[model samples]
Target: MTPAARLSAAIEVLADLEVRRRPVNDALRDWGQTHRFAGSKDRAALASIVYDALRRRASSIFLLGADSPRAVVLGMLRLGRGLEADDIARLFSGERFAPDALTDDERARLEAPIPDMPAASAGDFPEWLTESLERTFGDDLIAEMQALADRAPVDIRANTLKTTREALVSALAHLSPEPTSHAEAGLRFHAGDDGRGPALQVEPEFIQGLYEIQDEGSQLAALLSLAAPGEQVVDLCAGAGGKTLALAAQMDNRGQIFATDIDARRLAAIHERLSRSGVRNVQVRVPRGRFDPVRNPQVADPLADIAGTVDLVLVDAPCTGVGTWRRNPDAKWRLRPGALVERLADQATVLDRAAALVKPGGRIAYVTCSLLPEENDDAVSGFLERHADFESVAPSNVVEAAGLPHLAEFATPGGGLLLSPRRTDTDGFYVAILRNRAA
Candidate 1:
């Protein structure tokens, strides 16, 4: 498809996304399925323009003075996409199927002055994210916002137990992006040839499960859990088992790890992943212990089975998912101030409950994809202060222990680790690793 057609497609997808509150991926998928004639390049270009628009929605509107998809496409071409004014005009020219004739007023706005915008505008984030963004960002708000504006890299964690980084690199060699090996067992790579995404999915490496598509930020959260071989670990809120798989890799497939969630279907999906990845240690507990192929008891509360008995428990809790703004920029518009408050309350409840399963000297690590301090630090503090047994520790210590830089730290009432994406290059994940006092 022509550039114009792709932009037009993005506009249609964005419109649907706004109305249904569906994610960009879903909208794009539905649209793509409907338009089978569209090739790989067309989809890639369309997704890029759409996400770029979403990333800078506030500023795009401010710059172009028009909020239509065409205006957004024009604004991105001028400002975010870095296209020159003439180029933008050309892209929207009548010769193309993209947009209708660009008016003089639209041209003027594209060339208008750009100055210091408000925090939301500068950060390219929602106004609702103002206070939380300030707290998490502190003085370097602009730099962080700029970082978020770019398309996200595709980072993968090598299943260190089965594969080495070098081996994984060789398997993914046809793909050009180099993978950077992190301190823990993470291999970070970006899709420079964005158009070649399909080749990666069909590769034997992905088929073999030698590497899994996880963000570097998420790998940090998994490492933050600090699971060891033969230690009983529970990923209490193992949504799709990203961290659960990470935890299993850490345990060296020697200990019992329970992959759990309120959703049965999600847990069910882990089996194929486990089988492909050659992981044998995890027992999936869906709907309160329904996996009979495993030894876990249906009568067991699961938490009670390990209450004060687990060497490690991880609560990669659900939140506003603010940190994942890069992948799902539309979420920013959907988020309301009230949702932040509700998320904090939810985090507190999950933290306290997850902590209960930690054995004396065992640790329960709390984590969120949110960049908000209310979700990151405040949740840890509220729980630590109320629970006399748990204490705080420096996050730098954990990162250093895991061979990472000391971006930030906090001591628990009793000791724990807190980390955010602004300090870490990964996702906007906040992790606190706390040890339960030994009896």
Candidate 2:
């Protein structure tokens, strides 16, 4: 399909999403099913336009002075793709399969000087999050959130259990992979102009489990846990076992890792991943029966026997996923105030469970793929308040223990490392280490 035609299709898809409030992937898939004639390239191009529009949704609306899907796509062409006014005019020529001709108002708006916008509009994020983000980032809020509004590079971690980083990098040389700045095992691959990366899943090295597609920040989070060999660990929220596999590798297949999640469905893919990565130290513990800690406090848990004996407990707690906006821009717009409250509650519950599993002198690594202070610093503060026996590990000490002294600069006021796209060239992640002081 022509570029104009693709833009037209993207506008339709965005309109559907705005009305139905469904996921972008779902809406795109439905559009594809209906438009069977659209080729793979055409579909991919359409999706790219739609995603770019979403990535700069707030800014696009502010620039165009309208919120319609057509205005969004048109605004994205100028803002995201950096197209000139005449270039956009050619595409919106009202030809068949092309968008309607640009109105006189659109022409004037597109050619006008960009007006100063508020932080939320400038950064293309939810307006409700401005206060929290301002507190987290202070003066650099726009730069930080704008970085998140851009596309994300595809990152893959060399599975140390199967091969070394050097070896994996050589095997995937065709993809032009580069080593990540912070993560020793990470390799980064730039996405194409269409906002898609190489299909690493089908690569021979990937099929052989030489690497796993993990964000650099996520790899750093797992590494910071410092899950040493022969140390008993509990991956409290081991969804899909991404970090669980990383921990098993760090343990060199010596110590045991009790990997489990509240939702069995989330754990389903873990077994296959563990088998592929050649991880032997992880024990998959699926919930046996109905077990809601709040509803039935006495219900048996998978890790009940190992309570108060674990050397480390990794709480990769769930949050609003604001950090992943570079990859999931639609989520930022879809996020509501109620969702943050629910996540805060979930983080508290999981941290409490992780505290129960940590032995004396053991460590609990509290992690969130969120930039919100409510989920990061505030959550850790609340945990420290509830468990006086557990003290927040100093930023210097935590980074030293992880052998990543360079990260000490990203230390938060509440005592955690904050990694972000602008600051760390990675997805936003917050990690804090707490040590059990009571013997």
**Top candidate, metric lDDT:** 2
Q: Could you tell me how far off, in angstroms, the CA of residue 138 lies in candidate 1 after the best superposition?
A: 1.7
lDDT of 1 by residue, 1-439 (tens): 8877777777788788778987778888998899999987788888887888888887777777667766666777777867777877776767756677679888777677776678787778877777767766668876787666666767778888689878876766666545544435556555544422434556778788887888877887787677888988888888778888888887789989987874566676688888888889998776653422223335445455657778877888879987788777778878888888877776776677677778788888887887677777777778888888877656667766665555444332223443334455666776777778757
Q: All candidates: CA RMSD in angstroms?
A: 3.9, 1.0
Which numbered prediction scores highest in TM-score against the true structure? 2
Candidate 1: worst 10 consecutive residues by lDDT?
Answer: 410-419
lDDT of 2 by residue, 69-128 (tens): 998888888888888888999999999999999999999888887779989989999899
lDDT of 2 at 251: 86
Q: Which regions of candidate 2 fall more than 4 Å away from where they truly are?
A: 295-299
Task: Tell me the deviation in Å of residue 415 in model 1.
Answer: 8.0
lDDT of model 2 at residue 134? 97
